[model samples]
Every structure is written in structure tokens, then in C-alpha cells.
Target: MWKSGAACSATRVGVATIITTVFGMALADALIKQSSTAMTLWQIYVLRSALVLPILLVMARGRMNTGRYGWIALRSLALVLMYLGIYAAIPWLELSVVAAALYTSPLFIAGLSAIVLREPITSRHWLGILIGFAGVLLIVRPAASGFKPLALVPVGAAFLYAVAAVITRAKCSDMPTRALAVWLNLSLLVTGLAASLYLSRTGVGAGFDYPFLFGAWRPMSGRDGWVIVVLACLMIGISLGLARAYQSPRPQVIATFDYSFLIFATFWGFVFFGDIPDRLTLLGMGLIMLAGVIVLTAGTPEPTRLEKAKVARDQPLVPCRVKTRTRPQRTDTSPSNR
Candidate 1:
């Protein structure tokens, strides 16, 4: 029973929020890919993390004490691994391809939930998982003569992301959102610093000229520094928009719109890096997007026995009664006797 005007207004807001979030994320990825050419991946991570910390702290203010340190650290480590895999892949793989592969996290989440949470797997969920992996194979195309093993990197990233998501749900469910954000950025900063220092000592190796991975800590160009700064701000904006979108009354509706990230990624890839997907790859991306939508819309709700019993008890009961026929019986008996 939605009012049409209100529904339309909400839909508009949701669409705008999703669009902004996806664009922000895509832009951040594009900037990272660009920055990779001039700096090490660790440098980008450290700089971006450094820039984001102040913003996160300002937003979190005094509300950053809600999360348990152990769980937060675990989740942050998972995220660091996830980002490492993804940023490494971006330099070698097309942005759209990497993004499509990363979107497989939803399927991984479903499988992980079944294993770790002992949740039941429905036929529909299984079908979605199968289709999703199939799409991944199409993108990776390991058997194909032109296959690049680097394509698997994003798949690894997706797995880590799924693991982080599972941990968040299972262990950090009560953590304030801002507190979680703070810990995540802090982890990124520490990991980045460690990696950068190690690489600085080892030096960039042959065939690893990509500044984002093996390059030494050097002065960044004015332009690239600004790009990183902008990317950092965009990350914060994207996080906020995502929070708003998912927190909306119609999460399913907003969730569906999240697939737009692939489209935005594709557009940015073309515009920024001139990276284009082949016909087969495009088909694979479409399949992945479809499978993601299916999984997202097919929510897995596990009702406990107590909840089920409560529902049953809440239902109205119908009464049944037996009618007596003593008067009719007596009349028939008297007639028979006479």
C-alpha cells in the first residue's frame, strides 16, 4: 500500500544515491589504475588510507568504540588482502573484466554462509551459484588459447571480500558503522606502510616496473598526488552513499541498482584506459550481472523454530461444536410408542 508519489520520490532518491556510489567507486578505481603507473600499489594504498582517515575520524567522532578490536582487526585484514588482489589485477586486466569477476562475491557469500553459519542452501541459491561460477569461467576462459592467468587475481579478491562480509555479519553485527569504517581504514594504512617499507628495501624487480606494486617510495607528481587525494575523498563519499542506499526502506530495490557499478566501471575503463571487452567477455559480464541480481533478490531468511511456533500461535482458531437432538429424539420416540 504505497502512495504513488512517495514511492516515486523514494525510487528517484535511491537511483541517484546508487548512481553516485557506483560512479564514485568506479572513479576511485580508475584513479588507482592511473596512479599505479607512477607509484607503487602500496604507496597508493598508504596515501589513500592516510587521506581517508581524517574524514572517517571526523565522521565517527566519539562513536568509534562500539566494535570489538579482535573482530575489527580480522575484518580489516581480510579487506586488505581483498584490496591487494584487486589493485594488483587492475594494472594488467581490463577494469570491466576485473569488476565483473569481483562481483562474484555475492555467490561466495552464499556458499560461505551455508558452511560457516550452517544455513540451508536452497535449490535457487545453488542454481544462482552455479550460473555465477559459469559466468566466471567464461570471463577467465582458462582453457582458451588467449587466457591470461592474471584474470584469476580478481576472483581471489572476491573470495576475500566474501570472507570479510561473512565476518562482518557474524562477528561485528553490533558494531557501529562508523567504527567499522575507522578500523578498516586504519588496517589499510598499516598494511600499506609495511608493504611500502618492504618494497623500498627490496627495490623494484625486472618485469615489475608498475610503480603501484614494486616501485620505490619516491616523490609523486603534482597531478598524481591530486588524483590520489580526489580518489580518497571519493571513497568516503561512495561509502556514505552506499550506507544510505542500503539503509533505505527498500533495500532490495537499491541493491538491484548496485549492479550499475559494472556499467560505470566499463565506461570509466574506456574513458580512462581505453580498455574494451571482447564480445565473449561482454557476454560473460552480462551473465555475471544477471546471476548477481538473481542471488541478491533471492533473499535467504532462516526462521528459527521459536519464530515459526510464534507465527503458528498467532493465527486465529476456528471453533467446532456438536448440536444436541434431544427434542427431536423424544418426539420420534413418543410417535413410535403410540
Candidate 2:
């Protein structure tokens, strides 16, 4: 009974960690949306990355190593690409639509799990995947009159983001959560620098006048600048918190917490941008959230097929056999002999 209570407590703690991560992530997105109007997304990315370095260094506190540096770099690159794709698409799509589209990551993760993790997909999981894709359609609606094809960018990002999450789950198991957190922040910093350089070279330094840079340089108000800085700090916190939480529990359990982001996204959109999601977007996002909830509750780790098959081979097929003679079977024969 005590053990049961303890397990329940641990589950509750895991749930709380997810809640914290989701809210932090949602707020980070909201800040990005606000800052996008006044600052280049590239600038925001650069500023956020620069601001996070000190925090991550403090968090790392001397545990950094040369080993696995390449993997860390790879993870960082994937994350930067994921963010860049999502941010670029937001201006072209509704905030809620983008959020819902990106959150469809669980569906991608499911497919990746089957291939990379060798996890079995039950009928329910398949159904969830179908429902999730349907949800995406409702948001993007390529069939709709004059729908923009660019809206697919976030969906593409969602796939990449799912891959990153799977990699984190697979590769970071042996590394310190703090170490991974710090490395990811550093990677983002590097990615930001690269983006800035590219922009500068193209004469699209930062602003609406720059068009694709979204202009060469739109100066930000001091207040908005501070908000961007605060948001960067929040991003660091969210990344660190998520890394630590996954270290303590299964990804399946952690994934459920993602639904919380939808709620926060809706609330923040309304509060910060006066953005209200239309009925279709709300319906789609609800389905996406439901899909994530179901996927997490299913509790299957995404593993490569090889590892799964190997594990299966090692399990006992049946209980050990014990041969014995029954005394009753010999009684009639004994009586006849007597």
C-alpha cells in the first residue's frame, strides 16, 4: 500500500513537471509572436540564444565534456531548424493554426517510434494518428479556396521537431540533463550567429524594409526589447526543466504534459495579441491535444526496431517445465498386479 502511494506521488510529480514545461514553452511562443512585430525573428533568436548562455553555463557548472560533442551539436542544429521553420510560418498563418500544426509532432513521433524505436502501434494508436492528420488538414485546409502552400512549413517543422525529441530521448540517456540543456542553448546561440551573418551578407540586416529579414533593421522599443530578454530567460528555464523532467521519467509520460501548452497558447494569444482562434482552429487543436494525451497514456517508448527485436529474443517464452508421475494413474495397474 505504501509503495502504491509512493508510485502515485511520483506520477503526480511527473505531471507537475509537464505542466511547468508546457506553460513555459507556451509563454515563450507568445513572446516570440509579440517580438516578431517589433524585432526580426532572427534578432529575437540571436538575443534569446545570447541571453541563455550564461544561465546554461551556471547550470552546467563544470560537467561539460568533449565526448558526444558532435551529437550535442546535431541536436542543437535540429532545434534551430525547427524554431526557424515555425517562426517563419507564423506570419503566414494564424497563431493558433501554427500552434496546432506544430503540436501535431506526436503523430510524427509515433511514426518515428515505429521505425526507429520499433515500438508496436496498437489499433488505437493508428486511430489517433489518423485523427491527428485530420486535425492538421482542418487547420491548413489545402483544399480551401486560395489556401497558401507556405502553411506547410510548420507541418514540416513538426516532423523535424518530433525527430529531435526522439533523438533526445535516445541519445541523451547517459548524459547529465544539465549538460544536454547547456549544450542545446549553446547550439541555439551558434545557430543565431550563423543566421545573423547570413542576413548581414544579404543586406537584409534586420527590419520590415528588409522584407525577408522582414526589413534591414526595425529598431525595437526599449519595453519590447526587455520583453524579448525576459522571454529568452524563460526559454532557458523551459529547456532545462524539460531536460530534467525527462531524465526522471518515461517520454510517454512526459509527452502528455504537451497538451497543457495548447491551453496556455490559447490564453496567451487572447491576452497578448487579442488573437482569438476561429472555430475550425479550435476544433483542430482540440483533436491534436487529445491525440497527444492518448499517445502518452499508451506508454510505449520509441525505440529502434533492432533493439526491440533483440529484447524480445531474450525474454522467456514459457514457465520452466517440471515432469512428474501421478500416483492415481498407477493405482489400477497396482491393484491388478496384487
lDDT of 2 by residue, 97-187 (tens): 7778888888898889889987788767787888888888887889999688878998889898888878877775677777777777777
lDDT (C-alpha, whole model) for all candidates: 0.84, 0.76
How many pairs collide in each candidate, listed in order? 6, 15
List candidate 1 stretches off by more than 4 Å: 1-11, 202-210, 299-338
Flag regions of model 2 displaced more than 4 Å: 204-214, 247-254, 299-338
Model 1 residue 163 lDDT score: 95
Residue 206 accuracy (lDDT) in model 1: 32
Name the 10 consecutive residues with the lowest summed lDDT in model 1. Answer: 203-212
Name the best candidate (by lDDT): 1
Report the poorest 10 consecutive residues by lDDT, candidate 2: 208-217
